[model samples]
Target: MSHAEIEIERRDRVTHGDYIAKLDTSDSTAKLSWTDRQGVRHAEHTFVPPEARGKGVAEALVKALVADARQEGFKIAPDCSYVERYFDRHKDLSDLRA
Candidate 1:
């Protein structure tokens, strides 16, 4: 599915949450998972199924997490390699780092 056709959902529990992306036209889903630790949000993994590649699902997941962090006043630890690189490249996000 294209970026606009994907739907992103936030699934949060006590200690962790996932931003899950699902294609409107297919069964494919992608996720960016994170855990909450001592007031910080640690980005754990980014997963994109092969069928969902090149559709911005991964980026949308991370963006959702970042949006939450900003609005909720939590810092982020980009533990996942993809998130680490994303944080590295986005200078505006430096202030949000943990």
Candidate 2:
């Protein structure tokens, strides 16, 4: 499936300093964090079930995370390898990198 075909939902747990972008099913989540000091957010982990592979679900999640960081005036430390690579390809968003 394409990015447009996936429905990604953001669940924010501000009390826990974490957020998750979940696919329609609960099985997959791209987990992120506000786990660091200095107001930085971390893109920590992305999990796509085998059935969801190649569907752009993970990319959609990270894109939403990046968008949030941009709008919310926070920088991102992409600890997840996928997110790191995504940043590498989109250097235009480097200003948001921490």
Top candidate by TM-score: 1
Q: For model 2, which pairs clash?
A: none
Q: Relative to the unseen true structure, what is the Cα RMSD of model 1? A: 1.5
Please write out the lDDT profile of model 2 over residues 13-91, one tens digit for every residue. Answer: 6632544555565565544444554788777776776666676777787888888888889888888898899999999
Q: Where's the lowest-lDDT run of ten residues in candidate 2?
A: 14-23
Query: lDDT values of the candidates?
Result: 0.87, 0.72
> What is the per-residue lDDT of model 1 for residues 1-98, given as tens digits with 9 covering 90 to 100?
55566678999996998899876646867888889999899999999987767877788788888889899999999999989988998989999999
Q: How well does candidate 1 score on lDDT at residue 92? A: 99
Report the poorest 10 consecutive residues by lDDT, candidate 1.
Answer: 1-10
